[model samples]
Target: MAIPRLRPLLLVAVLLLRAFASLPTQAAARGGLDPSPGIADRKHGSSSRSLLQDQPEITEEMVRGYMSNFELESAIQDFGRRCANISRTYSIGKSVNGSPLWAIEISDKPGQREAEPAFKFIGNVHGDEPVGREVLMQLAYWLCDNYLKDPLAALIVENTHLHILPSMNPDGFALRRRGNANNVDLNRDFPDQFFPNNDDIKHRQPETRAIMNWIKQEHFTASASLHGGALVANYPWDGSRDTRKQYYGCPDDKTFRYMASLYSQSHYNMSLSKEFEGGITNGALWYPIYGGMQDWNYIHGGCFELTLEISDVKWPKASELLVIWKQNKMSMLNLVASLVKTGVHGRIFAADTGRPIPGSLMVKGIDSKINASGSFGDYHRILAPGQSYEVVASMEGYRPKRTRVMLGREATNLDFILDPDGAVRRTKPLRNDCGCSCNDNSNTGKPFLLREAYLWLYLLALFFLLALYLLFRRRMALRLAAHRHPPPKRPVAV
Candidate 1:
């Protein structure tokens, strides 16, 4: 009687265990589970500190000078109202403590999507580094104030969609800690290329998930996250496969270097840094960190991102915020302007349909690929200035087109119209015409057939699983009834 009662429960437990056992482990996934507490301060000679060390306590004195969460929210809302013509305010998501993660989008057409490339500036990734949040607000207002009067400002406003999220980890900001409300470091919360376990979306923190979703929706061409504690422009790859502290360069190393140099050279004194050559360093070389946001942005979001450490002191006095903003103002403006002033912008279309085809763009010798927009089939490829590149546009069922062009200081516009593979095949005669004598037909049709077969197989398996679950429940109910009311043993007439 006891055995029957425990059987169903035991089976259910076994199934659940099996299901969870299939989940990827941290070691198997190749990502670190915990945040790199000291990695942010590695350049400041604090790499030897323990990961569990208590964060610097924030006192009433510290809170006295900085803007509270309420004040920052008010400032953002006020900016939206004051710059209504050029900006739109929206919440990306909420932080762990339910603080709305607000963003200010600045463009001539603030809410609408255009054929132009989009750029994002995220600040205050860590709660204690509030300098970026303040500086970003200043950057927004300055652009609004000087759009028509300043050529660089006017160019950025008219040509690009600039999205600024002044604070990513607002809960951390309110708590005066490096991590969010749950004590998760938002910077190390992203999925890492070296560590696959971090790729589990369900386990990611709310702030990290919000950023991931935002990047997917925005289709940003390039972005930067502002930080404190150092004065260097850092670019990916942020970590190494062997977990060693060394230089690791991604496919777009040259382009990233160019972007980083643009910011450092434009700054008042960043280029003069004695530690980092030209005030720029590869992220891994500076200090290796797994699940960092910069590398993930480049690998997954298709947005080239630079981690800009703008100040030497983290949590600098609020009075010095304005001066810090001034020091980095030109660097900020020039970085955004580089999107429109440089790069190769173009669209892809089908020659026969005369309609846009969502294709991909690739450069010769560069392993990375840039995808075109689905709606307009437009693409923006950022490259170092004064170079020649072979750009290729490709899509399924269409012939790939390749072209060579010289990119100067100004952006080049290139378009591609691809001919259908079948159309090209029609021009040539086959040796035999049994309607199966074509290589192109076999190449395309097999994939479609395989896809359809897989769809049916998935549906069938789902139905079978549902039926098995129902049968198990029915058997458990019948067994419970037998246990509750024992049948008379009168049938023992052997």
Candidate 2:
């Protein structure tokens, strides 16, 4: 039976309704995602919104006016030549029509070279969602152009290795189609290795192959794929159901929630109360999507993946591109910065046996908080410093843990071995219960992990190696091809 096709506008509206309804419950219970600390109750008036909502509409005319064929090619080439240090090129496999699948790497540190965690900002996975391409391009340009002028830009590029494949489905991009040239949905092609894919079987597309290959080759810390026509950020590892029945959570669901909430706070203005006004966990803005880029990245790639629907429609007007960019730019910056900050470092184990506890922990300080380390023995929290703070650590079959730590000149490392009696211990909920301590933001936050000086040196080394490789290989390949062509017969025939 043929599936009924819906109009683009209707489909998007429906998707939004379904997504909004599916926002996870804010209950701090089993299989529920909770909101982090420092989540403001009210919007930051107009200034905050104005800063993010800079780009209003992206019309087709606007896209065509600035983003021409020549400009697209030039952007790709310029990225290859100018930003050679922070990135490398790879094949995404092939397209349906047999084209070279190209992906650009944007790592602050190399694969062999160890540093902070890595991330990939993939765009145009659906081909027609072209707004992501613009976002990625603008981000890269800003990073390169303001490497020295902007401290934040330089900080992000220096500490983080950001891999970006701005356009994943060039064939569909060329055709202006949502699906690939083969008419298959590229977003629905990821194979579920950890859990079985419960939806319709539509695996094994070329674009999927390329992404899978890249992910398998280089393990990233987190990733976000850009989509258009939706004004929400989706995170996960589920098959359209964000519950225990379909997709409960990732091993690092707590961390995913922390990061996703950060993006939401910085951009979407979505509070816990309004997060689920659309749906439960199935067909809403906050629902889980199975066989999705985010899910696959979380389960298979071991990286946190988020599906960022930039606009309110699948095909927003090109004029809205810049507006979406403004909305997303800072959120993206915050996410990268948080990932590199290397939050509160501590140890978690059994108080009785001093055995390590393998589970999740949450630590809250001032206006920022962090999810502790994935490794149970030792944990780290990424935080924004200043003010007296509190911490909480909990895992299944153990009593919840809470304490306070002060941030100052040194990295705060607290060691906790849970009591054997903690399994049955009942604890009271600790809030900012008192106004006793002083609240001050006088001191600026510090980088907990990779320092700026070391980060720049690493980025410098990465670009230097990339330059030598490209120069030497291009020269060799050109010479070999020239030898085979016999100097083009000296153009004598003309």
Candidate 3:
């Protein structure tokens, strides 16, 4: 009995010793992932001190030249008035402090919806990160000042619908904090893909709710949000499924890597960063954070988003803001231009009626699928260049159409006309989202199926009613004959 007890203790001791021995190896195998406050002032690393309070405290003097909430609103109004022809300013929603979350729309036809790819630039996600807000205003001004004069500006304005929201959290900006007036971190407030513990959308903050609703309404092709305290473009899969700090990538990992590389290389010195390789890092590989906006946008919004840290310090001197804008100008312009300059864009249509079909799209190996707009049936897909991909367009009542194309540096146009598969036709109604029915012919599969089912039901009901009437008349006639002629004899059997 004593030997058996000793044997169990010995086994437990050996297991403990092995676990202790493997600890250093696991940390060391991570290579140069060691993060500390001294490496950089930015709060981006695995170091506890870096994560806690790496950023210095903001002073009123430091933020002297920055625009106040009132000043920013005035600047937006000024831009709209100055460039009313190609730009329209509207409020997406109101913030916690009742500040209007203003957005600028820059396009040839500002308010009209065309078969064009849409891109949005959201700035000042954290109140303390004010660099984005100022830089975005400068971007709006630049586009307005150089629309027809500059080739790049005209390409962006004529091709893509660029929406810019200069300040996402005015309340936080006023409070000089990371969180909003409610003291909630907006970056960590989005619905998490890995953790569904607090995934209730209704309970989210108002600022977050506005962004969610905006994404649902718009068919954005791709977007990027601005943040400070680092100089790297962080791409999707921000959190690992097992909650481990490792390089976990999404299905569109290759395309995301390409996009991140593009932005970094376009920047002045981002590509030459000593900390990040090629000045681009996977979100989870850098430092995993749950409920991040980057992962949510890619997973749910059908929009490719990147978290761009354009500065080394969170709260730099206000004078450096302009210099920072100049550094990131080309990167911003190139990103917006890439929406139309590169990618696969086309419309899906029905073979029979030649009408637009609101179909979903898929690439051969990618796991994600994007939807086309119901009105124009236009879809924009971003893929890595210099590659051949089989793009599939699928709808419920139509046979999917696939085409293989070798994509190049320039955008490719490949329209698909799918034949209606009557064998698999469903009763889904055809939506006329253009506010007016343009076709008088009621020959769509949806209406035809409904009418066919109704006709069968009507015929069946008529047959049953006729059979019941005949039976009633025959019984009435038998009663009448019985009444006319009296019964002579009746035999009772016991």
Candidate 4:
């Protein structure tokens, strides 16, 4: 019995050794760790030849003209000093290696919160693709130099709050690789709606976490990331369910196409692409990817983001960088201007109290919803120009409002002052799917009962303060009485 068992064990060991011997070195070591899907698969030689493939070895001469990490930071600080009136420099967070992630915000009122729509341009999402970082610096300086003289630049600067994050992955840039210092791709590090690979927040990269926090804090209306290795404007639905490479679109698919077309059409020759029709392609359609920043922005950040591949070469000769900027200049300007030039923008308020309310907005027939800013009750909805749309505004405890508008080439202004729920006053207030606190009465479905109001909030705060004051005064009077009028019978016990 012991000899028979030994024979079977020897046979199993032989098969295991053969299997391990036949595996590719990279694949064997990886062991399905990072799929490194999407962009890495495009035209590269090698996890991520996907985004920035076909580039020569990253030699010092290759990156000679490109700004070093120190030079990039100096340029940022210089921009803040030179354009001090219209720009402010700040750090969002740090990279894994403690590289300061610097950002420049440019507007008529920099560093101040306003009701204007905010648009951000994130460059160098892939450290190896440094074209974006340089181009973004160009964009910032252009707006600074031409704020009043150029009409398009002026429109963007005055009507919108523009933010520029020159490089999102500095460590990756320094390493001359696609991923960060930890070798994780920043683009694929975001949380994916289709998969749970990045659901563990504790394991997210520092750069990715910084971006997520910034999105929630600033609440940008629209944004775009720059890339290379191809020349096309890529929109959302980056990855499809079942991991299939096909066209899967988000609810705002039409709006996204229109926005992408603006960038492509404005480019010097991007719209004339032979590969991408009209120089624009849906992300999933072009190449399906998981945990892409574009899709995550739309789903979680309420930001309409586009992944723009502006160059055919990843790390082109630094001499070619200016031409790249000049080619994409109009496209960038047009996209930012579109926020104020064409779209639906306004504030929401409670009808009775006349204060801003956190009302949610949705377009008829579109599945996605836009949440108005809690600070100003402000929302911006981008749509195709020269089209008709049915827009609806609703909040818990408030009567919903809907309207039809024929949107023109210029941006439209629409404000909704919703009345509190009154139809069913017998029910309780509850939170709705839109993250709004709604008071719902069960008696025949009534609306409006004051769940999210600045006026009610102020009043409740005042009432609590008054009650606190009275309680404190009453206690003081009792203390004084006890000190002045002591009981006489207690002395005998002592």
lDDT values, one for every candidate: 0.79, 0.55, 0.78, 0.80
Model 4 misplaced stretches (Cα beyond 4 Å): 1-55, 423-494
Best by lDDT: 4
Off by over 4 Å in 2: 1-63, 66-73, 107-112, 193-203, 240-251, 268-288, 342-494
Count clashes in each candidate, considering only residues at least 3 apart in sequence or on different chains: 4, 42, 0, 16
For model 1, which pairs clash?
Answer: 29-196, 29-197, 30-195, 31-195
Model 2 gets an lDDT of 0.55
Span of ten consecutive residues with least summed lDDT in model 3: 23-32
Per-residue lDDT over 318-436 for candidate 3, one digit per residue giving the tens place of the 0 to 100 score: 98998999999999999888887777887777755656778988998999999988877888888888998877888988777665677788777766656687534444332221111
Which lDDT tens digits does candidate 1 get at residues 1-494? 34465566556656654543332211100004343545445544532223234446667765676777899899999999999999999999999889999999999899997778899999999988889998999999999999989988888888889999999999999888898999888888887777664567878899898999999898799999999888999999987776566789999999999999999999989999998999999987777777888898898878999999998877777778888999999999999889888887777766565567789988889999989888777888899989988778889888776666777887777666566775632222111111211122223421112223334654565566667666777887899998899978777666
State the lDDT of candidate 4 residue by residue for 179-212, as single tens digits.
9999998988888786775778999999999999
Model 3 residue runs over 4 Å out of place are 1-52, 423-494
What is the per-residue lDDT of model 2 for residues 232-305, given as tens digits with 9 covering 90 to 100? 56655544222222335544555556676667667744323253332112212233233567766765555667
Name the candidate, 2 or 4, with the larger TM-score value.
4
lDDT for model 1, please. 0.79
Error of 1 at 7 (Å): 78
Point out the higher-scoring one by lDDT: 3 or 4. 4
